[model samples]
Target: MKIPFYRPYIGDEEIAEVISAIQSNWLSKGPKTVVFESEFAKSVGSEHGVGLNSCTAGLHLAQLALGIGPGDEVITTPYTFVATANTIIHCGAKPVFVDIDPKTCNIDADLIEQAITPRTKAIIPVHYGGYPCEMDRIQEIAQRYGLAIIEDAAHAVYTKYKDQPIGSIGNITCFSFYATKNLTTGEGGMITTADEELANRIRILSLHGMSRNAWTRYAAKGAWYYEVEQAGFKYNMTDIQAALGIIQLRKLEEMQMLRMQVARAYSEALADCEEIILPHDSHEHRHSWHLYPIRLEEDQLTISRNEMIDQLSEAGIGTSVHFIPVPKHPFYQEKGYRMEEYPETEKVFESVLSLPFFPGMTKEEVYYVADTVQSIISKHRR
Candidate 1:
């Protein structure tokens, strides 16, 4: 009865797609990748999509496409995965940290203006735990400040804010298809934008800045010659990964329903507990429910977060923390990012823990996790 933290919702459909891709012989970025990109963009209400090896790669390319470079600054939340800020660093730009809203654990939109300076070029709002951020307010602030928005949508796929899909809202939106994501491609990502020029630039930069991809160059009606417009990284998504993506995209809605069921079940089971706080979702947004994070009320409990995690592990239940805040890491600390600067993130990081959540989880397993959490907290209650 060992429950892993995450298990991909893969089936025979995914296997068949991969086999079809392998049989096609053109396994690199090819027709399957193109179809996957198109379907994904359409699903998210975006005009264009560029597939990449990972969300980190998409973020990096977005910065590059937007002309963000050294001496520029990008504002983002401190309470997010390191990839959010690391991409800014990769673009040779400075990442300005902002505190989060204690309730949603998202970047506080109200605090964004104070962080904006002459050098500030963009805002990267991470949809923390598949919950949509305050996008409308963030967009208004960006518009007033003349800054671009690059959404860190690693935890957001089907997420929507005020009936608008996340991928279509930001100037550049990035999505991840990691093994743990709501919809997985094992390891893949997509960048979506409305601007045709920017989409083309991202495509070029994702595959060594080449004028043409391997598919086009080797096609019977295509030319063998191509040009290098600029130096770029090797970040193209393969046909095999795209094969998985296509299948996953087709079944996304069904998977999301199951995830919501898990969230609801947890809420129903633990509604009476005053020693723990559940994740929050705004009425205006549709949460993708990627990760179910709970906060232990330290004032009501004698045990720390680590002890709870250890107890869950001993009970054959796996759990994890969403993030440690970018500044808490040693590398960021050396770079002058202090935890004290982000009080909300610092506080949330200490109390938060992610429970086992995935589409593949059964009803009994969901209850097992909820019951286990309740039992552990009861024993530790003050």
Candidate 2:
């Protein structure tokens, strides 16, 4: 069978729970969402987890909760999704983009200090491709600069950096449950934090600053009066989405095992292919393997990277690119950034291809993708 780029693994349990939610008539943020939050926090070793509408909301809320605004700068990688930068902009702050480390496609922790200015308030390090970033280095820089750290953990559901889970150590961390991410709530997000004050503020900010939820105010024997203590956004996650998340989170470990196995297979099969540079592991860090991207050696291969993607599709294999440099986007261009500032990001953009990876893929399919890619490269090798 042709392999898909990515697909969510929804079992009958998901269907049953979704129906239960629909029938319960409490389709808004209610018991299920709260339960999902509790379970997720426990699994990821977080003190608290607040469910939201999207990872963008999580990052934006993190900024609001931390009092980051005008005249503040958040340092981040230019190699992540535009949302990472856009969230900082939403807070009326600027995002100072740093170049990514060429090997791991993560923000270069060593270079972050140079970007820190008096105006720099925080650093939002992304766990790219589920690979744990050098958090020790990142946190040390943050501490030295007196800056907060909010992790963009959208791709790192199960990742650990130096034995610490991504959400456990960051000042605040944001995650995505988009269809393409490891865990899908169709469209949802989470904010995990150890700080009690930050967690309380984020919970309020996500629910339109309402002192109490509608379920608390309007449900049986509930009070109707409440106060809006904070001006906030409507970032709450609906029970429907959370219902899916509850089931998805339960299956995460099983899903991750399959993903890692596929990654290992790819690494072993492509070890001798000089035209491709395989993904790397961080020292003493566990990768979540959210993405499997191979960098093509264009000169050694007769076909361009773009052409390889085309050929993969023709051969019944779907592929994608993790990202283009954030600064190269038109919006960022308007803000006066050139590709020359990020050498590694610019070079990697041309060579990278995100192969199909998901829990639903079978071992036979994995081999098929591996063999097909090698065959295609063998035909094109100069």
Candidate 3:
């Protein structure tokens, strides 16, 4: 049996919502987007939500809304997608990299204070692989430093830090609805915040900095006259994507249960494998299980991670690495970032591989992948 890395669970409900949206004739950012923004915000216990084209846009807008600009530094983990750091560069701000906690693969809050300088304006903590970072301590640090917090929650839409939802904690939280995300709108994202003025600013910044969006400008009771408040980019979510988001939001809990089941099954099946280290789980925080990244104890095996990946592919099992560590990338390297600066991140990247994990994975498929992994390890045991 072949198991792909991920497959989104799109049901008839999503199809129906898309059909209804298309039939309405308003395909751009319209009523569906507005309703999606409201419902998603409410679900996450945030006061406001602004739908955008991608989570990258939300991150960029969050920095812009808080006036993070040239010479400003935003602290974030080197263990995440480059988009997390690229957004800071887009604003002409410097991205200061921090090493991750070896245990959680999230930013090490203990190291944050030492990285902060007078020019530091914000912290963008990423919830890696749906596991939340040490937010309480991060918040305390941010508070003491008077710094804004923009959560890179691309993998954490359903995550919670202690009793607080991920979206409700930070100054502005961004979520992705990409095709492979836990909750998908094909290619969309949302920004959530309790600050009303910040929400309004993000909304304006997402759609060309217009005083009013197309929905309001062309409505029967609206007028054509408007103002461009600031120079902004075109990053509005289309009605078609929001239509999918609306239905996806409704089915989120159900889909999450399936993902949890797959995660549980993997842990149980691989518990006896000495060469594999499972992902961390904590009762204190809810993990969204967006990616089931397992670290291979390479010292216990003769094969390298790349060799294991090749063996898995030959077995018809697909896998992927979570990230290459932002500092190791060519662009970041040219910008003076070095891998040695983030030892933990580089260590994790060498062994980490994301398994096939999605909402609708079959029990047989899960076991087959797990069994194949064990077989590979058995053959290569040192």
* Top-lDDT candidate index: 3
lDDT of 1 by residue, 157-249 (tens): 999998999899999999999999988999999999999999999999988889855458766687888788999889999999999999999
TM-score of each: 0.98, 0.97, 0.99
Q: Flag regions of model 3 displaced more than 4 Å.
A: none
Winner on lDDT between 1 and 2 is: 1
Instruction: State the C-alpha lDDT per candidate.
Output: 0.93, 0.90, 0.94
Question: Ranking by TM-score, best first?
Answer: 3, 1, 2
**How far is 189's C-alpha from truth in model 3 (Å)?**
0.5
* Cα RMSD to the true fold for all candidates: 0.9, 1.3, 0.9
Identify the superior model by TM-score, candidate 2 or candidate 3. 3
List model 2 lDDT by residue over 58-174, tens digit each.
Answer: 999999899999988999999998999998999999989899999999999889999989999999999999998888998888898799999999999999987888889889999
TM-score of 2: 0.97
lDDT tens readout by residue for model 3, 153-235: 99998999988899999999999999999999999999999999999998888888888564577777877888898887899
